[model samples]
Structures are given as C-alpha cells and as structure tokens.
Target: MSEDGARDDGRQQRQELGSFLRRQRERLDRTAYGLPPAGRGRAVGLRREEVSYLSGVSVTWYTWLEQGRDINPSRQVLDAVATTLRLTDAEHDYVLSLVGLAPRPATRADAVDIAPAQVQRFLDALDEHPAYALAPDWGIAGWNKAYERLYPGVATTAGENRNLLWLVFTDPSVRSLLDDWDDTSRRFLAEFRAEAGPRLSDPRYRDLISRLRAASVDFDTRWNEHGVGGFVSRERVFRHPELGRLVFEHHQLRPSDHLDLQLVVYVADAETRRRFARTKD
Candidate 1:
C-alpha cells in the first residue's frame, strides 16, 4: 500500500480500537456502578445521553461516536469518559494502547534509545528553521542547531526530563516565549494530562508531575481541572526576541512502526519567513 493508504489504515484502526475499548468500559461501569444493564434500552452500553453528560459531548455526537458511525472525537472527549469510568491505571493505559501509545512496561528499562541518525540529519537539514524530535511522552529526544537558537534554554538542562510541556509550564523563560500565557498553558496542560493518564503509575511520570506541581501554580490548577487535548494541527504565535511576534503552523508527524518518535516541524508565515531568512544571512 502507498504511504498515504497506510496512514489512513492506521487512523481507521485507531478509531475502531478507541470505540471498542470505550464500549467495553461503559458496559463494565454499568455493572460495577449499579447502573441498569444494557437491556431494552435504545442503545447498548451506557445510554448515549449519560456518556454525553459525563464526557461533555453532545448526545447526538456521542451516539454517533459509540455506534462507530461517521464521527471524529477529540482526545478531550475520550479522556472525559476515561475519567468518568474511573478506569484503573492499567485500564487507562489500555485506552491509550488502542491509539498505538503503548505504555512502558514496569520492568522496562528507563533508558530510551536515541533517535536514528537519519532523523538527526533531517532536523539538521532544516538549517533556517526550528525542528525537533520528541519521545512518546513528549521528552526532547533531539533538536537541530537552529531550534536551539530559536528556542533558547530548551535543551540546556541535562537528562531525559527535558519535556516541552514541563519547560512550558514550569520554566519561566520558556513560558515567556508565548504571548497568551494563560490560554497556552491551559491547553498544554490538558494535552499533557490526556497523554499522562496511561503513565500515571510510572515513578518517572509521578516524579515529573510532582516537580511541575511544586514549581508552577498555573500548572497545578490546570492539572487539577482534569482537562485533555490532542495534538491537532494548529497555528501558534510566538514572541521571539529578535523577530518579535511571529506566527507558524505546527505539524506533527508520527512514525508508523516506532510510534514513540514524533517529528514536529514549525513553518513560519511569509513575514516570519522573511525575518528568519534575513537573520540567517
């Protein structure tokens, strides 16, 4: 199959996996929580309205989603149901597993193998722009020289804990790079919460959460809100020291086999592109 076809297949499989897991969880909850069984009801599992109420999704949309009909759900909705179901840490991990984000086994080693040389070369080739590779849990795996120049203080700290979310929420220097600090921080925290559900039991993840909670009040508040978000394509505004306010489109490219490695590319607008070009010269 062509690469596009392969990607489409992966997307479809993930959708099915997500829906199936959700249905199973709902059924389990109905029994465990003493809700009526899925008998003589208009729908199987939890009523569409109940799931919608718990997940903050419209009833019609939730029905379509659970029915495995034509509907796309944001990570936020899936997360809400995961929280409502009170899924165990393992069950939460299973939810993410459906989407190809397999949790790190407890016995697994802490050390993650470095990104391939080809990936490093790809980052380096973007000489005039910022580009970086992130591990599954959003740790900074590798970055280009230009990325370092543009996003100073990003990789200055040593070790595997150099996570972008951590830097944005806890580090003052990184937080200052954005114009809309509160809005951006909340969205970032939500995204991290969605991703971290599966890894909450891991000591490494727990420690990271503790450190961030202690470091930033904003992080603590948003984390407690139990929000969730996904990595969708979007435009971001950054306040650069040299270039001033600049806009860029953020794109995330996930690996088919490895899944852990994600290539994030930032493309500047025409004005920002001109500024970057002039700075490089």
Candidate 2:
C-alpha cells in the first residue's frame, strides 16, 4: 500500500475505535455504576472527560483519542479506557484491532472450536481429585464430577456467568466455602495478574476486574496494589459447614494440544480422601 493509503487506513482505524468507544460508553448505565453522566453537555453517552477522569489521563489526551487523532495509546492506557467504557472481553480486543494494535478475530468460517468436551472427561478420570479446566480468559471451560461435588455449581454456571474469578469474588456460596477468604482472593488475583500480564488490555481481564470491583471492596484494594505472584500450584483447605476442614494439594497443567486451556487438579490428603469417599454416599 502507498504511504497515503497507509495513512488513510490508520485514520480509518482511529475513527472506528472512537466510534466503538462511544457506543460502549453510551450503552452503559451510569446509574448502575453509581456515577453520574460524565460527558460535557447533554451528550448521549459518557463524555470524553468522564473517561479521562476514570482512565487517569488528561482531558486533552482523552479528547484527542475520541477526536480520532493519530496518537498511539499504551497497553495500560488502553486497559484503563476499556475498563472505563465497561467493554466485554470481545469488545476490548476489537478496540485494539481498530487501533491496529491487535489482530482481528478470525471469522467463524476460519475459526476453530474453542474448548473441547474431552477435557471434561479427562477431569472425570481424575476421580479422586477435584479437577477442572479454565479457558485462556479464566472461565471454567470444563470440570469433573469431583470438582462439582466440592465447589458445586462453580464451574457450571449457566451462560456468560461461568467465570472462575466471578464465582470467587461474587458468589456467596463459593465465598462461604473458602477457609480464608481474604488470603485466597488476594492470591487468586495475584496469580491472575501474573497470568494476565500480556492480556492486561484485553476486555476479558478488564471485565473481570470491573465485576470484582463492584462486588468486593477487598478485590478493589488488592487490584489497585498491583501485586503479582507466580502461578504455582498450592494447597488449600476448604472449611465446609458440615464437611469440616478438607485439605488438598492443588496443581495446574496445560494440555499439550490446547495451549489456551489450563487443567487444575487437586489431590486430597488421607483424611480428605476418606471424606471424599463418604461425600459420594
């Protein structure tokens, strides 16, 4: 392509990005988030100024962005903007593509299937252990009966509500099942930060953050602290109201054929193994 054509393409991308951002902001109910309309005048959607305030950018910078100026936004800045606009994971990636910063998603014609069902069967085979699979974005892609028996309904949330982080932060049942809620939540977030480093700007990560912030003040604190931890498999003890202290050593495994999937398995202690046997009764 000629230099002029290239420049035109770039300009077109910016325009598209600005338009996408406007739609996302306008569609979001300010009242739902407890923030008044942020744009100047009676603008239909969130104002550029509102976005700037929330995204930690100067009004001028944000204005330039919405005005379709040929400016490059960093990943962190894009992440903040996506969060402020409340974009979904898919939409977040779309905005990046508009800026020529990310590759466009493959069309269904060319796209392969996401998670496979066999993964669930594999989890089932680890009958003694609680096992589940997480998608690249950390949604529960699949789980064995053992996992469901332990963290019931966690990996099996119907529809779009099937996110592991969402369950961890928002679900009261899941919360009550934890032995140390605060410690466990923080560790999950830290591991998330580590796993999500390259994908910080992606809508999937931003959407999870937004939901967690809305649901848990503790999540808000730890996220803002910017702590990161390695994703080492560790032990956990879930204190059930009736089941008492159930101990297990959990570890993560990646399927060789599916790089985007993570398999998590939990090995129980002797007592917990016995408890597992009885629970099946």
Candidate 3:
C-alpha cells in the first residue's frame, strides 16, 4: 500500500472507532454507573468527563479520542475505556483493531457464499437433528433435509431475504415457531450486533438494518436501543406446526478451515429425537 493509502486507512479506522465508542457510551444509562441520569434537555449518554473520570484517562485526551483527532491511545488506555463502556468481547476486539492493537477481521468478500461439500456432508450426517450453515453475514448458505423440514422457508427464501436475522424478524412463521419470540428475537438481534462489530457500517449490513427497520416495528425499536451480546448455547423450544412442542440445545461451531462460516445445529434429546423419528416414519 502507498503511504497516502495507509494514511487514509488509518484515518477511516480512527473515525469508525470514535463513532463506535460514542454509540456505546450513549446507549448506557448513567444511573447504572451510579451517576445521576441526564436531565430533560441534556444529552442522553455519559459525558466525556464522566467517561474519562471513570476510565482514569485525561478528559482532554478522551475528548480528542472521540473527535477522531490524530492520536495514538495505548492498549491499556483503550482497555480501560472499553471496560468503562462495558463493551462485549467482539466489541473490544473491534476497538483494538481500530488502533492497530489487534488483527483486523476478514471481510465477507474474502469468504465463500456457499458451504463446502465437507460441511454439507457433516450436516447431512446429523441425521434427524436439524443443522444449517451460515455465511459471514448470516446468510443461510446451506442446510440438511432435517433443517428444511424444521424451517421450510429456508429452502424457499431467496436472495437477500435468505439472511437469518432477516427471517427472525420479518418472517411470521419464525415468530410462530419460537416458543418465546420476544426473548428469542431480541437475543438474536443482540448477538448479531456484537458479531457485526466494525462491519456494521458495511453496505450489506446497512441495507439489512434499513430494511428491517422499515419492515418490523419491533426490530426498529430494539435496534435503537443498541443492545449487544455474545452468543450462548442453550436450550431452545419450538412449537412446530406438525411436530408439536420440541426441545433442543441450540449450538454453533466454526470450521477450522473456514472460520467465517458458522455451523448452527439443534441437538435433540430423547423425547425430541423420538418426535423427529416419528416425523421420519
């Protein structure tokens, strides 16, 4: 890369870092930090001084940091600021990448759009349990017959509409399938936000968010809240139209060779296994 190109890239990274920090800071309630809430007309987030004080950084330096001024913040300082803002694991890594403290994540463009044959075979080998592969942007790249049976829409949803987050929010069938749509949807949104990180500004991410905001009132409301969380493997309950009530442990894995692709699987217990077997018969 040319010297000029490197400079431009650094500038963009700083700007994105500043914006991300500001958003995270603003979304937090001052009261949660044992500080008084912002009064009527004041800005909603913690003031710069408050953050600096909490982070033990100089207020002037912190203000400059938010302004995207040409400055280098030490890893320790960044860590303190991230802690003060309660950034998640992914968010912290993103902040590090912005300042050349961590390696940048691979872009979706570098990844393949379809699941590898080996991955598809693995899904197929899952037998009755439903399993699917998710591309970097949460696109439903591939799935097994069991997954198709679990969510028939996956087999039919085409183009941009094939994204998991899009389906979770916009598909009425998904709402009907999940036993706890409100909680499940919110959790999914939070996880997506955390995973998206610096790529939130990418065109595809922006387009998806805009469409969801326009399509679902729930998504719009929750999105404005700026909630972020890491993914957790847990028991998920579903009310299948034909299968009735089903229980499974929702889990996800990343292939060593294809780190960007996520393999999401639903592992069934004995009762759920019997239910799946009955459907097969």
Candidate 4:
C-alpha cells in the first residue's frame, strides 16, 4: 500500500475506534459506578473525566482518544480503559486493532508454505503418534497416518478450509474430539492471532479471517475479542471413535532450518499406548 493510502487507513481506523469507545462509554449507567444521577440536561453515561479518573489516564489523553487524534495508545492504557468501561473480550480486541497493538509472531517468516519431502518423511516416521506440520500461516502442510486416523477430516478438508483455526472452529468432528472444546477453541484463536500479528493486513490473512467470520459465529466472536497468547505444551485429551479416551502431551517444534514451519506432535501416555497396542493386536 502507498504511504498516502496507509495514512488514510490509519485515520479511518482511529475515527472508528474513537466512535466505538464513545458509544460504549455513553451506554454505561453513571449510578452503576456510584456516581450521581444525570443532572438536568447532562447525558446519562459517565463523563470523560470520570472515565479518565477511573482508568488512570489523563483527562487530556482520554479526550484525545475519544476525539480520534493522531496520538498513540499503549496496551496497558487500553486494558485499563477496557476495564473501566467493562468492555467484552471482542470489544477490547477491536480497540487494540485500531491502535495496532495486537501480538506479533515470535518466529521468522522465511519458510515455504509447502513442507519439504524430508519433513514429510519425518512425520511419516511417527507411526504411533499423531503429528502434523504447520506452515507460517497455520495451514496444515503435512500430516502422518496417526493424525489422519485421529481426525479423518484433515485429509478431506478442501483448500483454504484446511487451516488449523478454521478446523478448530468449523469442523464438528474436531469440536467433538476435544474434551474441552470451549477453552481449546478460544486458546487456539488467541495463539493464531499472536502468530498472525505481522500479517494482519496481508490479503491472504484477511481472506482467511473473513472466510472464518462468515463461516462460523464462534470464530467471528472470538476474533472480535482479539485474545492473544503464546503456545505452550500441555496435556491433550481426545475421545477417539476407535480408541475411546486417549491422553497425550501436545508439543510444538520449529526446525532451525525451517523456522516458519511448526511441527505439532501428540505423544501418547501409557494407557493410550496400551490401547493402541490392543488395537494392533
């Protein structure tokens, strides 16, 4: 985008953000915060100064934000404001996006979208464990037989729909397999947003987000909340159709040569191992 276009976009975003904040503030009840009722012709909502006092910001800075000035806002300030206004997760994220404070990707973006043959071979070697490779954009680039067996949808999901975030939100099979669907889906969205920070404006990223918002209400709501978090290894439980209840440790690895490619693996526990062994017999 051209510098002029960038400036124009920024101005519009700020204006919209300001309008949203003002509307949310105006909708609040003054008495709810222990303030007196509206006097005479005063508006019902809390005053700008009251908001500033409650949010720990200067009156001038808060006014500038509501007025859509060119001033920048830090994440801490925004969080404080959100708390003062009792904004929902989606509302908070919307405000952050306007100010460009969403979390950025921690990894380098030099890896290719397609997994190399060697990478596929490595995944194939994990015969008893479910493993898959993720591209820089979180697209499923490769998977092993174990992963396919665990969730058959991966092999059948068409292009664009093959994304991990898309599947987590839109795929019924995946939703059913996860023991904690609500928490897992939300966390996945947060992690995906963290990785997508630098690419938020990219056409591909926008398209994927747009498609997801249109396809699933759950995804759209979570996206608006703008939750973001770093990935961490944790125990995952899946109620497999064939294996009953399976427990495994979910881990992610980034190869030194392919920093953009993330390898997700599920290592089985003893009970899960015995179950798999029984199935083989």
Q: Which candidate is the best by TM-score?
A: 3
Which ranges in model 2 have alpha carbons more than 4 Å from their true place? 1-114
lDDT of 2 by residue, 52-92 (tens): 89889898987777778999988778888988888876778
Model 2: per-residue Cα lDDT at residue 45: 63
Models sorted by TM-score, best on top = 3, 4, 1, 2
Write model 4 residue lDDT over 1-281, tens digit each, in one string: 99999999999998998899899999998877988877685547988999999999999999999999998899989999999999976688788888988842343444355688989999989877889999877889999888887888998889667889889988888999999999999888899888889777776777888989999999888889989999989999998988899999999998777767899999999888777666541
- Tens-digit lDDT track of model 3 for 123-162: 9999888999988778888898888888889978886688
TM-score of each: 0.59, 0.58, 0.63, 0.60
Error of 1 at 2 (Å): 28
Clashes per prediction?
0, 3, 0, 3
How much is the lDDT of residue 128 in candidate 1? Answer: 63
| Total backbone clashes of candidate 1, pairs 3 or more residues apart or in separate chains | 0
Ranking by lDDT: 3, 4, 2, 1
Q: Which candidate is the best by lDDT?
A: 3
Give candidate 3 misplaced runs (Cα > 4 Å).
Answer: 1-101, 106-112
Residue 48 shift from truth in candidate 2, angstroms: 51
lDDT of every predicted structure (CA atoms):
0.71, 0.77, 0.87, 0.86
